[model samples]
Target: MMGKTWIAAAICAAAIFSVFPESRAQQAPASPSVDAPELAALGSYGIGVADLEFIDKGRADPLQGADVPRVADRHISVKLWYPAAAKGGGTRYRTGLPGETGSDVPFEVPGLATPGAAMAKGRFPLVILAHGYSNTPEVLSWLGENLASKGYVVLAPAFRDPPITIRTPAARAGPLTSRPLDIAFVAAEAQRRAKAGEGLLAAADGARTALIGYSMGGYGVLTAAGAPLDPGLGGATRGVLAPFVAGGPKADTLKVADVKAVVAISPASNLYGTPLWAAPGVAAIRAPTLFIVGSQDHVVGYETGVRRLFDQEVHAPRYLLTFREAAHSIALIGAPPAMRESFWDFDWFEDAVWRKDRLMAVQAHFITAFLDRNVKGEAAKSSYLDGLVPNSNDGKWPNAPTGRYAGFSPGAPASTIWKGFQPSRVSGMNFEFRPGEP
Candidate 1:
């Protein structure tokens, strides 16, 4: 719960259960080669999806309002996955989730829904996800529907604002106002869809909604926390909000108060050059939070911004965990690369690329633990939050930070290792990753 209106509604919704559902999909095909629960347990040691299909972007450029430019009003897409009513039989393919109507790519999925089948329905907990900046909704394939397989309803929307074609001096000058609100809007709509029964994952309890974001989407979570954002510095970080301000500004406010809790991994905030959780806009978030990052991160370094956010927030219960061998995007699990590349130092603030579904399993487990404890009245299981991350065999299978990959060799005794996220005292069968060419 983050937006003011939504927070109020969420508060009222606490007692009202508005679970949505799409008509049951056609029959499922074959049972997945491996049951999903076993797949999830692998996160205990940081492995990834063995064989999963890609759910591509279904559509693009949705809302076309007067104030919104065509470029600004870009596409929205998402994929819906779950333990089908029956196992699937068709071949499995992998693709990004796109909006229901824009640009897209289609492939085989076991007993997958064909375009007009009902959206989906179930009585599952609703999890609305926000992707990082300049990324389509497909970026975090690591987490989404896989979590759905674990009995949760996952909703991921493409909220890339100002769509980076604004590379020119003139276009770059436009104000970036909608991104945060876009997240808020998407969350609200997900609830509406569930309440109205047009949603993908039908088993949704509107009262049990939670927010999960990465990178810029992380900033959107902060903004939704009912905090206020200050004017930031120039260059890649400035975004669309800078140039639109007029005399004394039109009140640059950001916050979302309805979220019961949030899990932000490798979010970007604070001044690039300076350190500290500079995005005070999210400071007003009084809900519980689970913040994950990498000690060895070079992309959004482990210094000022994200660190300060955790250090200063006093109202809500918050925790931060830094993966030893990981970087900004390494914390999740997804598709293994045909070949590995170390572009950790690539100028992402200025460029863009597709991050595979490497961290989904771990992302799903940690996030599930957070939601269970915070939104579902259960307890969280995190040793790092308790300052107990083991020094030896942690079951975390996170990717090393791009710049930090020493290229020594896989299993070469480097200073870092992970297995299913239990960073200390674990074994190999429970994990996957080779830091160097052993």
Candidate 2:
């Protein structure tokens, strides 16, 4: 009888192991493809990375109510990437799924950044990066590291969001409030540190700052940039979010001052069958903004979600970049191989029709141009953002001389193809621009 019991246990163990092979071998997955668009290439500066922590004292604790402390300190973990002296070797980041406990997966990304490398001279623009729901900063290393190399101090804060799969509306209260508040707090702290000339951010140019967020992070950055929350949101959180609503006593606290630029990628809004921000709410955003979205994004309805928000923000000088047949997974890096073993994990980083690497590259390219034009005050970069053929497929590139690759489009009369893009590589996309009131 004991032998039979042991046999049954052995069978159960085998079944479990077979379902999750990584549990046994614990092997790292193959690195994602490195192929990138022309402008997605790394900049001249070497990259350096560091991890830091910050605490928001006496903040409301929505996750735990009467039973636990009503107000507790919020601990935020930040992964910072910045310009550094060129160094050998790269960094491999380890991360896990939203609610996964136990094993974390490791994947090496091909890059020039060296962990703990010396900082490069001179102050560079500050960029506050916020990730999506239940996501860690490590997942956004592609953007953080790439921008750092291009002469920016990039900080990505871990919001410690609840799992995306959580169905209860109350489960969202914590993130809905914490997302913007955390971004606002980090921006303020980083600027303060910059002014004081202290720590790794000493060389950061806080005055020339930009906010970039993906999905929920996009929602956070938009609100933090000045888009006020809907009054109805207060009731959803049982008045826990009342103070941060538009015109609320703490409304000012949610905004970052004089934001130079804003980037919202697949931003989440209108998730509750209603718009999170009204026309007046979004009109408050004065910074030049860029909105990127997948036209067919079912996760955050394209027409009802980001597109609606874009249309309402008529007062801001904004541009919308639409991926023809893509989906909500537009902003993340390619799924590491281990994640591909399961549909749930793989969906987090991949799109059904678009290649993740290509999506990332295109994003990096446009974001670079936008930030450079608005934040760095590079007038030359404006050409890259403006005067483009709206539909990429309609753009024309006359045949070039043999033995030479087709060059970037020069815009308008010379070539209709969007500038800085290889001829064959540009398609299935649309770009629109609207100027703010002068």
Candidate 3:
């Protein structure tokens, strides 16, 4: 009987292992040994990081837990990554698990949190990064650090959202409703601080602002860029998202005129099988936007959620980049060391069909090109975005580079290669662009 019981346990383990083959395969290599080359900034200047705390007094605690009393004022923490003249060794940044106050565990980054890193000369544009639901800002350090390295100051604000442990869709409403407001307040404060010559962000160029939001953050950026919430969406929120209902007081505070562009990654547009933004509401988003999503995303349904949002925005010039067979979480930095012990935890930072590092590399390339062209007014960069192929793999380089394609050779005839991508690196991606209807 004991032998039979042991046999059953072994069978159960085998079944579990077979079900998550990709996770097991990825976990085999120790994370410390993997090279996250994609995380490195492409610019010549070193990166520096600093934390700023802002107070939104008299604001209701949107995520006040049912078990806890409400707090009148909301305290927001913002982490800023920027270009610096002084070089320093990379350091581990503090991060917390879901719902925790401060992280005891370290999330490694390639930048120093040195206040005296010596700000590089010239005014850099501001890029505010909003993370997914229940996620800390440092998980996106890869983007923040990389953008900073490329002469852009990136600010990631930690939202007072629901804990990751919460599984119910209803529990997400308060934080969901408050996300846009959080971004608006954070951006305004960062701009104010920069203009006032306050602290580390004194060199920040607030006139040029771009928002990059992932998952729920994506929803927030779209709304903040002027996409209105459907007046009827209040029913789906169970009154928790009432403030963001169209024509409500909160909805009036959503738009930010300074935003030059937005990038939404796996945004939660249709949460819990309900539409949050109607077609007319989405059409109001006039800012130039980019959408990055997985074709097989179940969390945010691809057809009805992301693709729908992309197709309805007929007013703005938009681009949609799809990863074939990939799921949500395409823009994450890396799997946190603390999450390595479990498959579900590790998956938060990885994709089943693609390497996270490579994905980030492609993201860095296109995003750099897009933002540089749109926000920085670098008209020359437009060459990289024009004439893109429908499918990444369809773009070919017969004269493939021995190491890297180094982008197209000067004046090389247009081959099948996707704009800005090297040989063989563009597989499994679909990029499309549509200008506003005349």
| lDDT tens per residue, model 2, 1-438 | 999999999999999978674432221111223444445777788889888898889887676776542788889899899999785477677666642432444454444467889999999999999998867777777888878888999999988766544356766776777788899999999999999999999999999999999988998999999988988778666676788887789988989976899999989886556457644867788899999999999877788787887887878999999999998888876676677777777787879999776788888889999999999899998888898878989888675333435555566666777887777778899999988875
RMSD each, Å = 17.4, 7.9, 7.9
Model 3 stretches with alpha carbons more than 4 Å out: 1-41, 65-71, 99-115, 164-166, 232-243, 398-412
Clash pairs for candidate 2: none
How many residue pairs clash in each candidate at the backbone level?
95, 0, 2
Candidate 2 whole-model C-alpha lDDT, 0 to 1: 0.80
- Highest TM-score, which number? 2
Q: Residue-wise lDDT of candidate 3 within 1-438, one digit each (tens)?
A: 999999999999998887674454333111211222222335777778888788888764435547442557777898888898866665666665541322233344333434547789889999989998777787777677778878899989898576444356555655565677788888888888889988777888888999999998998888888887876656544554467667777776777658888899898886665566754767887778889999999998799888988998899999898989999979876565566666766677778888877667667766777798889999877766677677767665666667743454221264667654545355788988989774
**Model 2, stretches more than 4 Å misplaced?**
1-35, 67-69, 99-111, 402-406
Local distance difference test, each candidate: 0.45, 0.80, 0.73
* lDDT of candidate 1 over 147-261, digit per residue (tens): 5545556666654445334334333222234445455555666566667876353446666777777876676666666555444422323333433222115233333324677
Stretches of candidate 1 above 4 Å error? 1-39, 42-75, 81-83, 89-122, 160-178, 199-202, 231-257, 271-280, 331-360, 380-438
Model 3 collision count: 2
The alpha-carbon deviation from the true structure for residue 201 of candidate 1, after best TM-score superposition, in angstroms, is 6.0
Rank candidates, lDDT, best first.
Answer: 2, 3, 1
